[model samples]
Target: MINAKNLTKRFGKVDALKGLNLHVKKGSIQGLIGPNGAGKSTTIKILSTLVIANSGDVTINDIPLKRGVSVRSMIGVVPETPRLHENKSARSELRFHAKLYGMSQKEAKSRISDLLYAVQLEDAADRPIRGYSTGMKKRVALALALLHEPEILLLDEPMSGLDPVIRKQFKEIILDLKEMGKTILVSDHDLYTVEELCDSVTIIQDGKTVVEDTIESLRHETGSIAIELRVSDDSTMDGLESKLTSLDCVTDVSQKRGWVIVKVRDSKTDIPVVIHTASNHTDILEAKQTKITLEDIFLKFAGGHHG
Candidate 1:
């Protein structure tokens, strides 16, 4: 339950967010994705009350963002690079945060214990954060965020720079949060993670939202289902391409590696026709249907084909 309208933020001459708008539904994971300079982090900062927007209206859980203290109480934030006291043990770090949140001794003890277990750091709870790995630090950051039991989470690049194992763990943790009814807004460049975790996504470019919809709806709207085929004979590639290009159902055709990638309006009805056309010119080596991916959606709407 987070909303921002016409959000604009500037630093000197550069505008980080130019009329950016976002809406994160209650109890759902919403993804904020864009290119390197598209202002994904800036949007997260504004929502977390770490940075004030130049001009915008924001609300968290129906409470106006103008009440920074109230908004802060309802949301937990984990930045791209988590900051922690290197000398302190993970338990001490979380315990200190519990104090800052005004948690009572008994309450703090139990909550900290639960969070450490939740983040899978109970075994290393006594280890100094200085010796922890990047993934371990991320887990500590997540534990710190949950220390106060906030209703919403704002995660900026939580899955960045993690090995596959740790990434899988984080995915499970985030999903568990959703099961606990926490609304989450994740800003990340990892399209695979976004596709796996988010209920809906908002794609922004040039500091503005270009598209916002569920993954399925976006895929259908773009009509990007593909029929990928490879010709057995390299010499016959050109002929096969020309034949597939003439089919009315084929929206576009391109080549990659040794495969002919054809974007079609409807895969179920177009795949057989595309295969038949290709077979007429050359022996079909391989063929398969593929669904549109988040990266495909990003290039289409965010216009970063070359970037």
Candidate 2:
């Protein structure tokens, strides 16, 4: 439902985005992830029409981003740091946003009521936003974003300061939106959350698109698999590492906290060999395969130049 091509943005001499391309399918949640200064926020701002890119083409629902082709009504944005009127109650703030979208008094009130309930802010709807906790404020922001019931949702670090409880709650809300056919593009540093919530992910680094694919596909393409082996004796750890390193499938080996961590080319085919080799060297306390994570992929791409 959203497409951005050849997006390039620059401020002074620093380029924030360099020919970055992102695509989000309808009713799917796409995660945009990168390290600091990797142009994640800049991409969101351009898609939200808050910042005009120096060179790029973006469209929402086949509507090109140009003058007179209104896209704001079709998008809901929840920024990393939401700004709300401190003195205004949650209900009042939502009403204000609804009115800004030209909703009538009756419609605005109905939407405000429903949104407050959806974000679980019904009880505190009348309280001023300044007194709200960080999680509470995030809920208020989410309510405000859905006030217009837009077709597309852009969430930049939506779970930034949320506690575990609220974070789970927020994730449920996103899942519900997806079921309702809302196209969502969410960016966050939490790889686990992204892996859990996103259908596909786009990894960008140094203002460039490094990789974009499903988590499984990315993991397979990267060929990064890990195995954790607990040895009974620390002295035998070096021998175990040496044995595992001799295997052709094994790429690198290291020891941590009395455990030998081995990186392999393919865990499915190489883990058994790793176990057999370790068994001959030391008493195996535990030998388990570790799935490659999104963080591992991010570090592999963003930390260094690797295709």
Candidate 3:
């Protein structure tokens, strides 16, 4: 439902967005993943009509995204950091948002109650936000963003710094919103979470789109499936190399200090060949196959694994 073409945003000598182009289908749960200084938050701000780009074009729902009186009625925004008034109670904070949207006192109260329940914050509704936990405040922020029932949500690192349980809750909430046909554009570096939650992804590096596709398709395009071989000795890689590469699925192989790393075009049938090679052609302690996770793909492209 959103389209950006030749979008470039520069701050002095730094190009935060270097001719970025994005296409997010309507009602799709799409992710924007990249490293630090990858222009993720900048893209969110431009789309939310909160920041003006120097030059570019973007459209939301066939309408050009420009500063307009009614733009607020169609978009919801959750920033990377919670900006709630520390002194305000959670209930009051949501109510304030409802008031800004011109809801009557009774309507605001009813909506606030429903939102508090949706976010599972009813028990702590009366506590000042200053005393709330990180996850608690994020829930309230999400509730406030949804108070107006906007059609699209722009989330900037919505799950950053949350515990695993809280991340699962947020992922479920995002999926629920997707089911309701609310278009979501989220920027996060958490590959595992994004792969679990997003239908498609657009990967950026150094302020440019590198890959954009369904997670599975991107994995395929990476041209390799990870093959983990537990061999009695790493020297087995040499005896198995010819047989392993002879298989159609096996594309490449590498031997480490004692482990064999094979990149396969497909893991379904190729894994067994690897095991057979390790067993008959050579010697092995064990062998198994696993799909290459997004983390693996990122590390491959990043030139070296971080740890």
Candidate 4:
């Protein structure tokens, strides 16, 4: 439902985005992730029509984004740090946005009540936003964004700086939105959250698109699997690394905290062989495939830059 091609943006001499292309299917949550200055926010700004790109073509639901072409009505944007009127109550804030969208008094009130309940801010809806916690503020921003019920949602670092409990709540809200068939493009620094929430991820680095695919597909395409084996004792790990390394499918092996980690060519066949080899030397405490995490994939693409 969202498409951008050859998007480029610059500030003075620094290029924020360079020929970045992105696509999000309808009813799917797509993640845009990168280190600092990788242009994730810039991409979202362009998509939200908050900032015009230096060069590119963009469309939401086939309606082109150009001068005088109104795409804002079709998009809901919740910035990384949403700027809400601190003194205004959550209900009032949403009401203002609803009126801005030209909703009638009755319709706006009904929608505002539903959104407050949806964000779980019903009791505190009458309280001024300045007294709310960071997570609560995010919920208010989200409710404001959905006031008009836009078809597309752009959330930039919506879960950043949130505690585990609040982050979980926020994730559930996003999932609920997805269930309602909203096309979502979320930019986040948290790889774990992105992996859990997004259907597909687009990794950009140095102002360029590095990779875009489902997490499982990226792991498969990377073709590196780690098999972790815990021996009963450290002495049992001795010579085990060499033995595993000698195998045809084993690429590399290392010991950590009394556990032998073997990088293999194939997990399905190599793991069984690794287990059999270790069984000859030591009693196995634990043997399992070490699943590759999103952090591993991000490090590979971003070169360990965690900014």
Candidate 5:
């Protein structure tokens, strides 16, 4: 439901987005991940029409994004910081947001109740936001953003500075929203959560996309794939490493902590030949397999370029 082509944004001499290209399919939760100062918030601002881009084009739900297409009515935004009035009750602030969306009192009240319950802030709804904790205030902010049930949701580090229990609860809410089929674009530092929730992702580094793909596809594409080849004896390891390195897909080999760590250019599915080769040549114990994750991909790509 969102598209960007050669999208570039700059501030002073530094480019925040450098020819960035993005395509997010409808009904999928797409995660945007990167380290600090990687232009994530800059991109979000451009999409939400909060900031203008210097060059390139964007389209949201079939409307040219630069043409002032009432995107506010069609999108929900949960900013990194909650900006709520200090003295107003949470319920009143949400009701005001509903009114901004042209909601009637009955509609506003109904939505307020639903959001309060949704964010687990029902008890705090009547209390002034000045007295609410950071988590409670954020809940109210999210509720205000969702007051209109917009088509697309943009969350910037949605789970920040909360305890583990609240983080889990928030993750569940994001998953529940995904089930409800709102196209979501989330940027988070928590790689585990991103791996769990994102259907696809784009990792940016130094204002450029370093990698973009499904979690599995990316894991396969970026690094030297490998599988474990365990053997009880150290006498045969040199032979195993030499044999594995000679294979077509295998790029490197090493023995670490008494396990044969072989690196290849392809998937672990294809590494059994190396295992088989090792097994036929020596006494074998057991082998284990592992897949690279989003964090691995991030460290490989964003970490290097950003550093």
Candidate 6:
């Protein structure tokens, strides 16, 4: 439903995006994640029509981003920091946007009522936005974004500053939007939320895309299991790493602090051999098995290359 190719943008001498590419399938929630200054916000801004790219091609629902085509009506945007009228109540805010959207009074009222309920701010819909908490303000922003019932949503850090309760509620609302067949592109630093919410992810670095694929495919390609081993003797750690590296099942082995971290392909078969091999070197202090997460994948592909 959304596509961008070879998108590049520059401000003075610094390049915010250098050939960054992204794609989102219809009815799927896609994640855009990277380190700070990796051009995530810049990408979102260009996609939302807030910033024009220096050179690139973009389309929303097959509508090319050109002077004559109208992509704004097809997309809703929830920025990292929502800018709302502090004095206006949520209901009034929605009402104002509804007018800008060209909705009649009856339609605007009904739509505004539904959105207030959807964001769980029905009781406080009439309260001034300035008195609302951060989470409440975000809810208001979300409601405003959905007031037009756009086909796609571009969310830049939607989970930022939200409490656990509000975050959970926000997640549920996003899932509900997916079920309703809305295409979503979320740019967030919260990998856990991305793992839970996204069908696929695009990791970028230094203003370029490093990798883009489904989480399942990334896990399989990057090795899913990690074996963290702490040995009784610090001297034996180096020897253990060498032995684990020679094993066919182990993908990677490295030492950190007093622990030897090993990435393995098959946990069931590899874990035992890994433990047994370490036992031969020295007494085992601790051996724990963990699944490699999105964060691990992020560091593997996008880390150590940042300027």
The TM-scores, one per candidate, come to 0.94, 0.92, 0.89, 0.91, 0.86, 0.90
The whole-model lDDT of each prediction reads 0.87, 0.88, 0.81, 0.87, 0.82, 0.90
Kindly report which residue stretches of model 1 are placed more than 4 angstroms away from their true locations once superposed.
67-69, 305-307
Best by TM-score: 1
Q: At residue 28, what lDDT does model 1 achieve?
A: 94
Stretches of candidate 2 off by over 4 Å are 265-268, 305-307
- The list of candidate 6 runs beyond 4 A from truth reads 230-239, 255-259, 282-288
lDDT of 5 by residue, 256-278 (tens): 88888876665645677877788
How much is 78 displaced in model 2, in angstroms? Answer: 0.4
RMSD of each: 1.8, 2.3, 2.8, 2.2, 2.9, 2.3
Clashing pairs in 1: none
lDDT of 3 by residue, 1-307 (tens): 8888777788899889887788899999899988888888888888888788877888988888765634667889988887999999999998888888999999989889988987889999999999999888888888888899899998888887778887887888899999999999988888888888888888776767777778778788776576866676655567776667777777777666576778888666777766766678666766656677888666656433221
Candidate 4 per-residue lDDT over residues 164-236, each given as its tens digit: 8767888998998899999999998788889899988899987788998888888766546888888877776
Cα distance off (Å), candidate 2, residue 47: 0.2
- Output the lDDT of residue 143, model 3: 89
* Clash number for each model: 0, 0, 4, 0, 0, 0
Choose the strongest candidate by lDDT. 6
lDDT of 3 at 149: 89
Between candidates 2 and 6, the one scoring higher on lDDT is 6
TM-score of 3: 0.89
What are the per-residue Cα lDDT tens digits for candidate 2 across 1-307? 9999999999999899999999999999999998877889999988988888999899899889976667999999998788999999999898888778999999888878888877888989998999999889989989877888899999999998888987998999999999999999999989999999998999998888888888888787655688999988888988888888888988778888888988888666888888888888889998877877888778777867532
lDDT of model 1 at residue 223?
Answer: 67
In model 4, the runs with Cα more than 4 Å from the true position are 235-238, 251-256, 304-307
